[model samples]
Structure formats: C-alpha cells, structure tokens
Target: MQRNFEHRKVALGTCGRAYNTPCIHEHSCLRCSLLRPDPQQRGRLTEVRDHLLARIDEAHREGWLGEVDGLRISLAGAEHKLAQLGELTTRTATVHLGLPHFSHLVGRTVR
Candidate 1:
C-alpha cells in the first residue's frame, strides 16, 4: 500500500498568510522597503535649508551681494554634504537590515 501526504507551505514572515512575491519577508505590505531618515533629522535639514535661503534672500534684498553670495556658496556646500550623509546612512541601513539573511545564506552554503 502506498500513501501520499500533502504539505501546505506557509508564508515565511506573515504567520500563514499567502506569500507576497515581491517581498519575501511579506512585511512591507505595499510600502517600498527603503530606509528613511529619522523624522527629526529630516525636519532639521528642511529647517536649516529654509532658514539659509531666507537669510540669503534678505541679504540680496538689502543690496548686500557679498553676504548673499557667501551664504549661497555655504548653503550649496552644506546641502551637498547632507546628501552624501543621507546616502551613506541609507547604504548602512540596507546592509545592516540584510545581515541576517546574508548570514543564513552563508551558513547554508558552508554547511
């Protein structure tokens, strides 16, 4: 006599829900899994950029071209540095979050 058994596969991180193809973890639920900076950091950067622009505009309106030009250069440099930092943070977050999966794969391959 032969017996057949059927195995049901449960989605890995969704507690038995149907698997979502795009996200293997199934936790994103329609959201892109991109890392975003903390709200405070985002708000602070916006505030600083707005304040610098306002100051530059005020200096220009008062006929202070030298100050306005200096502020413009400074703001541009600061914005560039902020963008670089944001990129670094995002890369770091991606690597950090992926470490567990990477380790699992490594373990399986080594074994």
Candidate 2:
C-alpha cells in the first residue's frame, strides 16, 4: 500500500469522511488525517490564520460564544502548524555575495 499524495494548500479530510460530511477543509488542517502541511504553503496558512482571527472577533462581537470557541481552536491549530512549517526552512546567516579575498593578486602584474 503505497499512497501517492499531492501538494495542497488546504487539505480536506475526505478519506476519513464517509460521503457528504461537512468537513471545512481550510479550518480543519490540524485535525486532518491527510494534511500535507508544507513550508511552501506558509503564506496561505498565514492568510487563513488572519481570516480566522477576523471571524473570531466578529463572533465575539455577536455574542456567539460557540462560534468563537470553535474558531479559536482552529486558529490555535493553524498557528501550531505555522510554527512547525517555519522550522523546516532556515535562512543563511552569512552569504558571500562579494568577490573572494585576493591576497595573491597583490604581486601580479597586468598582462
């Protein structure tokens, strides 16, 4: 049983859901059975977090505690995924873009 997986910005747990289950794909990455959360999808995840935050705020204003709670949990999970993805790639601290040091060229004459 080798399984092939594709890159997805938001993976819906379709495998676990038995036909017509209302699985909110974007908000369910953390609990997804087949979530391929890659570092390349960081930007999309960040945007999702932002959108969830706005929804959470709106829910709070509307006194919808249930909605706020659910949104908050999803928000936390997305944040955790972001942290994991963030650790995947590292930035080079010292990049040698300039020319190499040429101490031997000091004694060389122009041809």
Candidate 3:
C-alpha cells in the first residue's frame, strides 16, 4: 500500500548514504559497500572531546567540579557542551579565515 511504500522510502533515506542508491542487481547488492565517515568530521569530534576532557580535568583540579554526582552530570553534559563549542569554533574560524559572514553577504548588490 501507499503507507508501506512511504515507510520504505523514509527508511532508505535514513539508512543509506545521500548519493548512494541501493543496487538493483543481485550480484552488486551482495557486495554491499560501507559508508565511510568523513575524516574531517571525525577529527573535529576527537578534538572537541579532548578539549572538553581537558577542561573538565582542569575544573576538577581547581575544585570547580565537586562530588561524584556532579562529575557524572558534567560527563553526561560533555557531548552537548562539545556541540556548542564546535559551533562557536566553526563560526569563529570561518570569520577569522576571511569568509564573509552569511548575514553580511546577503542582500548586497555587486557593482
């Protein structure tokens, strides 16, 4: 039915790589290709993790993070903190690298 087809489509989109279509032939389909993680993204995530861990360590050394429960909460929040830091780092890097800000570039007429 239509509902089944729609569900299949959504599942395919979520599960597969954007440009990679499932093989139609049996032989090709048998040899399934694995999607590779983006190296830059992996590197960025590792960098973020290390930086956050170091900050947490520094905070603990300075008595900023108190008790085991507080440490657990801080560890749990590290991913969210890293995501926020990543966004800010990306924005700052983009600006520092001389790329015009999206807002500044928008609606400007070129002479």
Candidate 4:
C-alpha cells in the first residue's frame, strides 16, 4: 500500500485485505494488523526498522519517553514482518529429492 506522509510518498507493502478500503491506522501501516508486507520490499522494511530503533534511542536521550514506547511498538511490528518474510523464503526454498527407481517394476508384467 502507498502512504502520503510529510509531503512524500512511501510504499508500505501490499494490503492482504479487501481493496479500496480506508485505512484505520492513520497512515501508520507498520503497526497495523492488515499490513501484509511484501517480500520484495524487505530492504524498505529493514530501513524502517533501523530508523525506528534510532528514533527510540534518540527519544531516550532527548527525554521523549512517550515517543519511545510508540517507537518500540512499531519496531516490534517491523521485526514481525521481517520474520514473516524469512519464513516465506524458508517455505518456498528448493529441496532436492532423488529420482525414482524403476528396477523392481521393470520385471513386473502389466495387469
């Protein structure tokens, strides 16, 4: 899904739900349950995760305690999406199986 924030457009990945529906998260896609992160967008999501981590650190040092909590929540969501991508990769990974042997069947007569 695309989001327009701060005069810039950001692609937050694809939405798994129905199309043409309004977002209830106020353009905060990371923490929303409806967000089905795209595997191709891993880099962007990683950037967001890193940014959130830095923001949390800055918030702590700058005494922005309230912001840190929200940042942490977003961080968790980012990590979760990353994990989902990882799992998808694992599930779709190639596996090799040996070719079938027909030696025993070679001597058998057809029914």
- Cα lDDT of model 4 by residue, 1-111, tens digit: 244331232376766545555668777878877777778899999999999999999999999999999899989999998998888888956778889888987878877
Between the candidate structures 2 and 3, which one is better when assessed by TM-score?
Answer: 2
Stretches of candidate 3 exceeding 4 Å from the true structure:
1-39, 66-111
**Candidate 2 lDDT tens digits, 1-111:** 223233223442223443444666644566554554666678888898999999998998999999998898888878877776666566555777988888988998988
Give residue 12's lDDT in candidate 1 (0 to 100).
Answer: 14
| CA lDDT scores, all candidates in order | 0.51, 0.69, 0.44, 0.80
Off by over 4 Å in 1: 1-40, 92-111
lDDT of 1 by residue, 1-111 (tens): 122122222221112332333445344211222223243355555666688899998998999999987778657744754564567566744334443445545645532
TM values, all candidates? 0.42, 0.56, 0.28, 0.69
Clash pairs, model 3 backbone: none
Clashes of each: 0, 0, 0, 1
> Which candidate leads in TM-score?
4
Off by over 4 Å in 4: 1-10, 93-111
Say which prediction, candidate 2 or candidate 3, comes out ahead on lDDT: 2
lDDT of 3 at 10: 26
